[model samples]
Target: MRITTETVAAAMKSALPNKTKYHFDDDLAGFGFYRTTTGTGTFFAEFRTVAGGSKKRLKLGRVGTLKANEAREAARKAIANAALGKDLAKSRAEGRAAATVARLLELYNERTRDKRKASTADGYDLIAKVNIVPHIGATKAAAVTRQEVQRMHGKVGKARGHYAANRAVAVLKAAYAWGGKHGHVPEGFNPASGVDRYREEPRERFLTDAEMIAIGDAMTEAETIGLAVDAGTAKHAPVGQRVVMSPYATAAVRLIMLTGARLREILHLRWDEVDLERGILRLPDSKTGKKLVYLPTAAIDIIKGLTPIGAFVIAGESAGTKREKPRADLKKPWAAILKRAGVSGIRIHDLRHTFASIGVGDQMGLPVIGALLGHSNAATTKRYAHAADEVQRRAVEAIGGKIAAALGGVK
Candidate 1:
């Protein structure tokens, strides 16, 4: 039932030895409550902030910890904080110490934008919007604790997929680190730290040379690669399977395949940042927010092939409409390519994994491969640096010495 302070007063008046239900309606800010959802003294307070806004709930305290007067006082304080511009939702989030999650996200995005690429900004938005905001967005940045982070890690990292959870944590940690350095959040080691606890399991996704050849050939022949629908044909996929692939798609996919530049980088490419004649594509700001990527010959060829007669290399295939251009999924083309190549369960991103593997197979150094991939750190590159089991075993069982010894007698 709906709760308010008057109902809470009535429940407290009828209280017995067990935890009792209470409600409070403060400031027409809507109604909230104090009750036990599962019984046995575990109290929860649920409420709505505005007359028609969403209903939000928070855990108040245990039976002994919260008396009616105590709950009433707490509610009063919350209302006061809200009136004074603090949010209880934020309170339930990070605890009671630092900045709120919302503020941190805002700061990070604002500071990183034109300073970085549109794609980079978009990526941060996705991760924050999906993982952080829904769970702990309201939490105060300073109030977030190690235990809270651990619980979160368990949930988001889920049972077997820890990579995404780890990434989300990394983003938070980086934010905190930045916060401390710049006086955004208090100075302290990241709450998400401690490798032994939140450590991630290994994930492998790389293609062999044979697999690469097959997939590449398949992609070249696939009928329906994704592209932004030009204006005249917004509702339907283009009549012709191939529309010369927009300058963006052509250069972007080629670049993505060759150098594995994030899709955002390709979407936001500007002519001024490239020097086709000099074979250099300059990134004004990287994810690290420092160091421009210097594209070598092959990457240059991909960019060279992408010359939009106007701004944005892809020139956006909106067909001259106000609506934003649609991203090319490559799903159909990817599926066809995979089927033709007899491969399954691989993603376009794996093509990036392919780039790293091919580099490793060619005996190129790890650091060189990373630099080519535009990774700012060795750690990021190492994810793709791991060779397949067969490949690794091939190195150990070369039989170079033994073959030479058997031939040595002949020699």
Candidate 2:
């Protein structure tokens, strides 16, 4: 029956549990409602086709949010739009193409990674695939729920259990929700909702005095091997081979050790951001999004040998695009150096660990060390606690005994 005023009242009261009311008869073109977990609304279209008798049905709205007459009119409009050779569904796709879970990943790469930081964009890809697309990327956007979000959170929690893993999942949740919000998918999705946002427990990993010395020795040996091999490799180049390692990388590493700056801060450095005479390396912005850095003498000499031909401090690395160029990873040479120097289980980031460890070892004040590390929160700086302060005293007279002995039996 067509949804006339009388028919709508009857259909609204009708409990049609298991059948689809296919076509409209007479003035009743198309009309029916099926009870569902998602509330109720459907409209019928009685249309004639060349392939004999034909019928179609379309959803009206969630039962309570829309009135019966309102639904009837909306369905009529949808039918009219459909008749015009335009897809109402396709019109609302908002230009985002997510074919399979894999395709969503590809589109996400084009939209995010191509223009953003490599490290940042890689993170979006990793979690979106590992957590989301596998579970529900195929599910139509309208079908998501709070329970599914909880499952995703649990999955990330199970897989990594680290602060980073949970954090990655949160970012992925944000991205999916963002997709929905922008009409890439339907809105009102609770992708990041209903899951407990757990706090990361305290983690401290600064190396000890012995460990620091061992790693430094390893780094030195690695530099030796790198220098020995770099020349032979560079000579065979046909024409213009991009220089992989900067002359200042070693000294810069030393400066990272001495000053406790983040790896990216120095790695992304530019000549425009430096000041030789003022002995200051002024940053326009940092990971914190504020531009601030004070470079002491150690940072200057390390880069003094550098000719900043490109946009970065290690002098020649690329920035601003993901695929600009490839640079050498510190892995092999570092491993060779570490093996020769007899160090074990240390990463390049551990250099920062060593830096923090030294400050804690030197009897320096905790707040002072925190400032040197550029930490806004003392709690973050506190990771160096017990480890940062066990090494030295303020006055040189405290170590005069060693100096006296070095004076060749003058003592």
Encode model 1's per-residue lDDT on 1-411: one tens digit a residue. Answer: 334445554554553534445544444233345444444333344555555656555555544545645655565666555555566866554443556876887787778677656766776777787777777889877777788877776777774357767777777777777665444665454676763345655546777778778865655554245333344444446543443333444345557777666555555566787777766667676555544555668887666665455555656655335664635344544554566679887777776777778777767777987887777778877765456444666776676656867787733
In Å, residue 221's CA in model 1 sits off its true spot by 3.8
Global lDDT scores for all candidate models: 0.61, 0.58
**Worst-scoring 10-residue span by lDDT in model 1:** 240-249
Q: List residue ranges in candidate 2 displaced over 4 A.
A: 1-87, 90-98, 102-168, 186-201, 225-249, 307-309, 315-336, 360-363, 387-411
lDDT of candidate 2? 0.58
Q: TM per model? A: 0.49, 0.55
lDDT of 2 by residue, 1-411 (tens): 554556655655666546444334354344444453332444433333223534444444444455557766766676676666544455555334433434544555666666666656755776676666676668544445667656766776777565544775566566556555434555455455656756786544556667667756655554443333333344644333433333456655666676677766676667677777887667665654554565667666667766655566664345335554323345554554455556766666777766767766767788877766667788887777666434444345557877887887766
